[model samples]
Target: MPAAINPPVVLVLGASGLLGRAVHHTLLESLPHGVVVVGTGHSRARGLIPCDVTDETTLREFLAAQAPRVVVNCVAERRPDVVEKEDAKARVLNVRLVEILAEESARLGFYLLHISTDYVFDGTKPPYKPGDDPHPLNAYGEQKLASEKVLRGEDSGERVRPGQGSREEKQGGWDKVWTEVLYGPSADLAESSVTLLARDVLAPLRSSQKKVDDWAARYATHTEDVARVVTAMVDRALTGAGELRGTFHYSSKERSQDLSREEGGEQRPGQGGGRAYTKYSISVLIGEVLGRATKHLEPEASPPEGAPRPQDCELDISALQEALGEEATRSRALRDGLREVLQALAANRMPPPPSSAARLRLLLAGLSARQKSLALPGAFNGLVARAVAHAGFEATYVSGAGVAAGMGLPDVGLAGLEDMTRVIRDVSACSGLPLLADADTGGEGGEGGVRRVVMEYQRAGAAALHVEDQVFPKRCGHLEGKELVPADEFALKVQAAARARDEGQVAGEEGGGNGGLMICARTDARSVVGVEEVIERAKRYVDAGADMIFPEGLCSGDEFLRVSQALKGYNGVNGGEGPYLLANMTEFGKTPLLSVRRMGALGYHATIFPMTLFRWAMRGVLEALEELREGGRVSKTALREGRLLTRQETYELLGYTPGRVWEYPNANAYSRRKGTRRSDFVQEGKEVMEEEDENEASGYGEENPKKK
Candidate 1:
């Protein structure tokens, strides 16, 4: 009788990580019946054979014991931050380990499928073919590129090639595969960016805002897709059907769409799955899948901090497609992949919407506990607010003047409740910072108007709103001819605003008082009446339930101090919490420009840089216009010199991801509902199409007149 033939052994190193686990599972499911698969991991807890690939003795011993036909090497420190922090250690695993594997493969004659990264490229120019010159930006990429060199024999001066023998005899050799931004099932969410985002970023968005990098373009590939490709290559190599050699790129391509029916015969890059995504866009997709509002997630348009990352290291996968066909190289859509991940994470439970009241409380706490005055820079629009947030301001100010100027109107109360509320909503949405909006004179409709303005601003998500004592059609507090209403009448309006805020608070809600909305009463009486009367009216406003006082148009630091002292003294006398004192440090204002520290030292809680950014922005616009008119065009050199916001910077500021759909956090619920209905409609349509096809095949519709 013929001796029993043993099955070929396939070894998977680093089988505990996101990619390793996937490749191991895929080989188990896809390989021919006689192929035996063995997975080894550094840790025994994951049920993988405890074998540290970094230990040359242990690895070689394991290899000799298994006598494997194929070795899928998935071990590497992939985190850019970790790799940067521990360069020497990472190099040992990333490069040295590969060198060992290559040597082992050449000797043992086992096919080695090594995993690489798209980070081998500098990412400046993308769709990088395998032959493209490598220029890694960070230590992680540098090490990955080094490992590839080792495999290609450039480092060792001995090209590692497949062993020449019979198909059955030459079961082991070496090849390299590159992939990008892998994400899929893992025991730990931190193992993959996609899972980390779902579990860490989107899940906790209710209490805190998160900033995700939206500048770097990434092709998020699912680990499962990569696993299938690895399995297929291994199967081919073992079966001797094909030879897998050279460096190959494997990435999840954005799905192609048929644009033949599209108007203008053109389709946007974001309309299909072939498009790259920024981290922000990925977060948006995750949010949609989780049914969570992404309003609390701000897109950082700039490159992320820590290790340097490539901007767009999109790998060109033509080699993989050519070798395996389109179906084999195809990847799951990002959303669909995320849905699977989210399901594994928490059964796809939706996180609660971010709380506006919580943001207001954050502002209040910041003002109350700040060692220095909280500087609130005025943001006229959402873009400006995003800039403010990026600048690291604790809170933002929606200046009435800034808003009015943006609308091409004068700051004479022409920007009414609707106007101010519009800006408030925009700034709140974009900045994700506590906002203090300017409500001039609380509109012209007296106490009722004041109440309406308060409610509207509160609903618009303003953490605080300040109503000045100046009459309707009010002049800029710093400008001349500013008139104040009667102290009693203005006090009534302040009382009405405060009451409206309190009434709007939801009962039984956490930190519910006034829904965390602060009503700051601004006394313009410093210019109209006197500093003494300014203090008097401020006291009256506070007594009428104002949460803060803005002493507008105070001419000197002495006056600011006096008003602040008076308010503090009044609070002492009243024996309860006193209203926060706010100082206006607007440029060219009657008030002297005081540093935030100086204001804090003088007992002020907050300071507003109203119109500061707006003024600077306007000056920039004028300069650009003048340069254009004089030179017939602005010089590219001038533009590149950081004199203007770059197109990429503008996109970042706007949180606009090119080649992706715009995600509105506020409309997430509607979008999810619509998506469900659309999916159902498509499924139903497919069913109908199937029925019609069956009838056609059965001749049911061809001659129904005989039955009739």
Candidate 2:
């Protein structure tokens, strides 16, 4: 059955921020249908409809404009010093904005999502939970706690009811209904710049007995994890399984240390009682949010007293773990992440590969199950992840087709390495699959070229990559229009890729250098030379240290069988330790799509899936764009549903608050967006140069379309 009608239109107030962007990305990929997500801000996005969160009039206008069913707020600033110094400004954003967004959501009968901070609790207890009382230490945390009280509070002082608390046709005020922080992400990497400086300066000196940089890692949230929570929430809401609301922690799922029990069940006296505040062992207000531990300073006999030694930051994040899922939990397991990332780089792969995972396993696991077997280095990307999820699949293919065809752009190296990296990042985000991507000509010519490309790819994440010895304007793997860079140069590139792949894996002091990029040397020699010489060049290429060989443009089954048998022997002097080879079988290309099981039966270990996602993505985007133009509003149907955002939704993501000058509409300001004067106005035009079409000027239905 289809999801019911009247799906909530989530309005995001601020759509641009680390967490906001991450959340938006998650929503786009995971949310269900019937969810309308609109956005509001100074800018617009593919799935976001912009609006101003601080402007009550504009907020209402947009609210009525989209008739939102939900409004999520992830915006906040709980910095104590910032708040104390600018309390008035801070309240506008952190406190006032929350009330405003909530009120609007309630008026429209939409679910309100407001993301809060961990700073709400003072350092009075250890392992504070959600139900614990909160006694904020500073202005920022206090304000955050205060806002929570407002949401949970009964009508009291300054309730601002219309006509003096006697309800009679109210215009705008507050609401009692709201959702709480369901999850959050790594906060250690950000907002703790100060903490990091100290650690960097303190830790090294302590190590050398020379001097230490004052710095320490903190327990904070990862934006990616936060996004997962948002998506999960949407999924639950769409499925009618979302009962968890109010204030829920959006942290990890690890079992945290139990809260310490003192006389007041707290160490500090000023802290209030019974608010369910989360308490870490020590002060959780270290440098970053998900820094992960409480810091301790290395005590030395008073530190030589010159420039005082820097202090370590004190922070923790175990409380967050108890609330997140396994995958979403923050792990210190950097090795696994690095390994998966390295494998992807070596394979030259992408996700949504050529053949389905099942087929790949059946036809292309390895080249011939007999004595002549094709060895495939581990693959990475979505293919492997999908195979694991679906089961029964063994071989992997990279999505070059998805990259090219999906963008509706030619795959002739037009999209730079960054484009490819972005695809791999998304594909690798969840799928722990090993993949081989199509790296045209090692991204240049020489081995140095290979090193540069492979190094970056490793950082971006890939199992392996295929660097075809092809010239400029390289055609599709199965197409005829292509040329090869000299075999020797290509061979050098392959070796370089091998080196880079290794370095990338052991990043950060352990790997000697920044090694860990992997490369699969590919050769189109088969297509150019007749069948026999193909083996000759393949041998020379393999001799030059190719991790895996991708011999493109092989014909029929007989041809595949022979090629598979040709390069069967010859390993480097390291005994049988030679590079593994793979097969490229793309449908509608020169090569026929061999089943993975069949390939495995033959001699191919892995299959390269290029251009699949690119094609599908292109078709979908083109269709969606055309529909939006015709309808005057973008279609949320084709978009990853449940993730569709509205204006209010954006605000939360951007950490929007009434204090943010960019947000509020002002009747008093002389230099505000809504004030008497304007700081800057967007230069909207057809082509950043062309004016709106003349047809748009004459109030045509296409331009303004009357309200139904």
Candidate 3:
């Protein structure tokens, strides 16, 4: 049987402070399995003990009872103003309390660790050492130094001069020396200031702001990095890895650029006495990491108000570097340290909504994956879109022919680019499906017209669009007597679509990127020229940066297979793993109605059932109208009854509730129950009215029932 093991308890004093909380979270996330960590603070807080450090009697009793394996003292009277006013209380809290803890550590045989500051030395020195002579100029520093003296036994008396303590004393010849300076949150050299700057930079960066400031400065370590170092040191002591008992110092290194710069520029008297200094500002560093855009930053020769004012507070970490070797320096890398801080900040940060371009790219990428999928046709009107979405379809096809039929017009390219975009927008708002739009010849104006069409469709929240090579007055794919544009002309239109997607005016929310905009090249040449010409045109379109090849009028599985095989070696413009093949399986079209499973077997990645639902809906409407004309009203048969989508179903599909209407007596109550405010819901009424108009104009609205 294995021997029983009592988990070691690590107690952290002042756990409610910024540094303490950082250490607590880090240890909780990164510590070993058998180590238990507890935190105590002066005030009662979640995950913190309300033990007062000034009350030595209660503190001693608590320490004696708990008897933690390791006691890390983070408590101190750090506020300079408070220390200056209440010197006695500061002495008791910072110095005398440390003495009591040191005594307790000896009695309990626990490794006592205390945090000390760099302010123990006057600013006259640059990079002070662990053995540096104390010359604190302020009460806060004096109390901190006094605490260090008592902990080290440099002055064993109950009281000693401020700044008179050293860690040279050990009760049982065990060194208990640990001190820090200018300590704070990781890479948080500029605290709330960085947050405000981040806010100001966000909008401009999104708008492609270009400006760079000539900023430079030293780097700060992340709290997690420092915490890792401390944890490693503790682990070393526990495991007897090396001599970690004696005085040792640790601080993050400066940036390579800061180090490479000459240190012999100029120095003011009383600044420091190490070397002639060349301290550059760090605005560039903040700009580069925080905003991800350096041009937006404007550098200045002098430090701005409330900027990093110190000429140099660099610490010599050679001793620590030599002790831990690579492990010590690895975690303190400046870029990694900065990222760690940003990552932590982002965890607490609520990110802005994703841009339309990003959403489009993600949808395209999802479609390009190895799995085969079907593109079920949805009406241009919001009515059919809701029905399609409720039917559990993954994606929706906004077919030009389907839209023309919904508008009660022939599919003769009657709707302009703007009209189609409006239909796409209406459908997109009501349905959660990623829409694949049909951009026939990209609207009249040659390549430039095609570019605008592609840009506008992406802006209208279309995930993908197929630009066909049909002539100006192009008919529906299933219709006879369709004229085809020349191969080169079609290829230019494809290139223009690609260019618009990649270099067009992307929305501000999306930032500038061609990603998430899927472009497919649809060739109508299969019917006009032949299957061979369609394959040839598709290859040309692929080379022109089309993401997928949509071959129109494929008569059979054999025709679809031949086209897929010819494009086997071709890759998408976006560096996709393989070529994407989209087969149009429109009912009453040249292509046969093949299931998604059958399409996959023929090497087709996606199949579109464009006009399938529209054909069924039109047949049902014709029968219902005939029944109304003959029987004095629509028949109450299964076909007519099923066609009548209930008012409740329509409301539910439109994401509406009776409590949403302001006229409802309990409208506010419903908002409260949903944890939403009425103000946030005010715009919902307008959107619903807009959707109703769109449906009515498209002749799909069945009038929602009036409330009683």
Candidate 4:
């Protein structure tokens, strides 16, 4: 029987790296509902915490907070030249980090899968089997070799110093330790699984039916299947019901076929008869997968000059099969995995520069150049952001008012910098849209404070922020009795924010680029100092490096038109015709709620419906509670039509498959058995004649193994 395992919360370190990205994609594709995949790195593309794995304290704090059941460490400083030059940094990253991870893994009872490289072995021998003695010839290889020791008890001398404590007194000195080793190109460490290799890596090709004549050294694995094995191991570990507490090596299962068979050969791909599985020469496998003729695929007899790389470092996975069961040997065919890579290459033949900053820059350019483009930001949190993204909004917004209301507080300066930033992060994770956040007087601190607030919001993945000219205890823009700070003082705060944004850009901080830190300077001065002063403040704010001009609390259409016309000819960040305008259409606001069409006619670029959704949700909640008070029971009619999102729609919004994947085998193809050509659900006692006939034709079946 399958174990009753809840989907585990998994964390992938170095998610921006090649191997890490593949693992991240596999987890998202294969894991069932309730599985949380937190991928973190020091890159904006990672879309999570800007984490540095070398900082033990920061890593510890993150681990404690997340408390993940599985931590996949895909981080390594593997560049030999860099490591040799800075051995201290390399040791801190590659060696010391593993020690800390093992300690934490034991204490936290989480499974750790640290990715080590094939560089741990020198190229003196061909087909260096698993468990062979490592003879590293470089600084990079030394660090990886040392990390393997740290996982086992071999490198525990520093922890168990003389007279410091008894062996058993140490925190992670328990005998029940689980360790696993994988050599060359396990799905856990293969770069090719996620990226398309350049043509040079697969050139000088020939097409032939026969296998290659020469022998060369290379290793590869299908990571998609490997990910499944790892997930299973993690699940069992979480239940504490597995005897898999020891080292094991994982590598691809090799198979060879008579390629001389014609295109219409009796045997199809992945079909085997009496032929035993045998390792294919690296040249033959590469030629077959890449569609290159065997004659053109040459194998190098020796390593290239100055390139210290292992040759024929093939891992023996017999132990891995025993530990992970028969499924470990059922890896996908090399041709199939290569087809995926080829497809990606064909689709992205001339791939554009990919980064969050680049995307945001394009989004900004589009929004600015398009005459009177409108966006509606109503996301209260990440979940709502998903729904909002599906609703087809060009951009998202984090409303300070909505954040305060979500926390069951009034928008009277209650949402601090961190609180709003947390909301921004959550919202950013669920949507790819560039977000504009509301910053209330840059979070209430004085003197060089708005700059820090700007930096924090930028780090949280906000594309733009609007800092209003409000006093310390700022109220909602639509609310009565709102007060404003002096125009010059507010301008200084705007300048500080601009400087902070510029500095971040220079340092290559997250969100720091062409569309980086967009400052939308807002003025509530119309109520405090009348129209002329409001116009003057808007001009000064733009002069202080504001990207967009937000004139809050406009009383009429004529007033909004005046503000828009006054800001014309002002060069915003994206070099648009005029400063982008933001119009807030809050319910019960002083300004009438205008349609996006009318707002555009008045020259407003973006319109925000900040508190509309929250108010609507609360009204429904109150009415439902009142109904429960009167009826004291549940009824079908109680939930009005379209009152809430349907389960199917919610599932679609959350990126979930339509059916229960665990119960429905065909719901997710990734969960199916390896080498199974067809994914289908069979009714009980119902014979699938088509599949049976295909299996019989291929000379393979459950009851009979066909002979050649």
Candidate 3 has what TM-score?
0.46
lDDT tens per residue, model 3, 1-708: 232244566677876665566666556555664465666653322234457678878889878645566777767776666788888978998888888877776666667666766656664566766676767767887887777777666776564322232422332112333333223342122232322243333322444453322232233444455666666666664555643665566655544443343357543221223222221123344445553434554435454332123334455566767777767544444444444454444332212223333433433333333244555565667667766665545567898887777777887888778778877776665554567898877877787787778767876667778988888788888778999888888888888877777775555313234545678889888888899998888888888878788988889889988887788656534343345678888777677888887887677766777777888877888877887888887556844557786788777666567764322112222222343322221122222222322212121121222331
Worst 10 residues of 2 by lDDT: 699-708
lDDT of 2 at 543: 72
**Scored by CA lDDT, what does every candidate get?**
0.71, 0.46, 0.60, 0.60
What lDDT would candidate 4 get against the real structure? 0.60
- Rank by lDDT, descending? 1, 4, 3, 2
**Model 1, residue 363: C-alpha shift (Å):** 4.2
Which lDDT tens digits does candidate 2 get at residues 439-552? 666676466666777765554445456777777667766667567677676667666766665554335311212112334567777777666766766777777766456677
- The C-alpha stretches of model 3 lying farther than 4 A from their native spots are 1-370, 509-514, 571-576, 634-643, 661-708
Error of 3 at 564 (Å): 1.1
Using alpha carbons, what is the TM-score of model 2?
A: 0.37
Highest-lDDT candidate: 1
RMSD of each: 23.4, 21.7, 21.7, 24.5
For model 4, how does the per-residue alpha-carbon lDDT over 1-708 read when each residue is reduced to its tens digit?
Answer: 232233356787876665565566666555653456666665233233347687889888778656666787877776677788899988998899887777776666566766676677775673445567888877888888888887765886654321123322222221111112222131111333122222222333336332322332344565555566666655565555552544455655443454323356754433332122222343454445544434543444444444365544555556667666786446666556655544343332211122344334444333333344466667888777766666655567889889988998888888788788888777766665567898888865654678778777776667788888888788777677877888888888888888888777334345443446778899988887787888888888888888788888889999988887777766543343556678888889788888877887787878888877788878988987887888896456755666666798777777566432221111111111121222111212222232333212121122111110
lDDT per residue as tens, model 1, 1-708: 232244677888887677887887778667865466666664221224557777789778868766777889999999999998999989889988887787777677888899999988888887799889999999999999888887766775554644532334465566789999988864335667766665433332356677888788877888889998898899888887876888899887663232312466665443443446777778777767666567888888898889888898888888889998888888887778877765554422222222444444433333343334778899998778777766546578998888889999988777767788778777766666667888878877777777777767766767788888887667888788887889898889888887777776433222225345788899888777789998899889988888889888888888877877677646532123357788888887667788988987787878889889989988989988998999998798786798877889887666577654343222222232233111111111112222233212121112111121
Runs off by more than 4 Å, candidate 1: 1-357, 363-370, 505-514, 572-577, 656-708
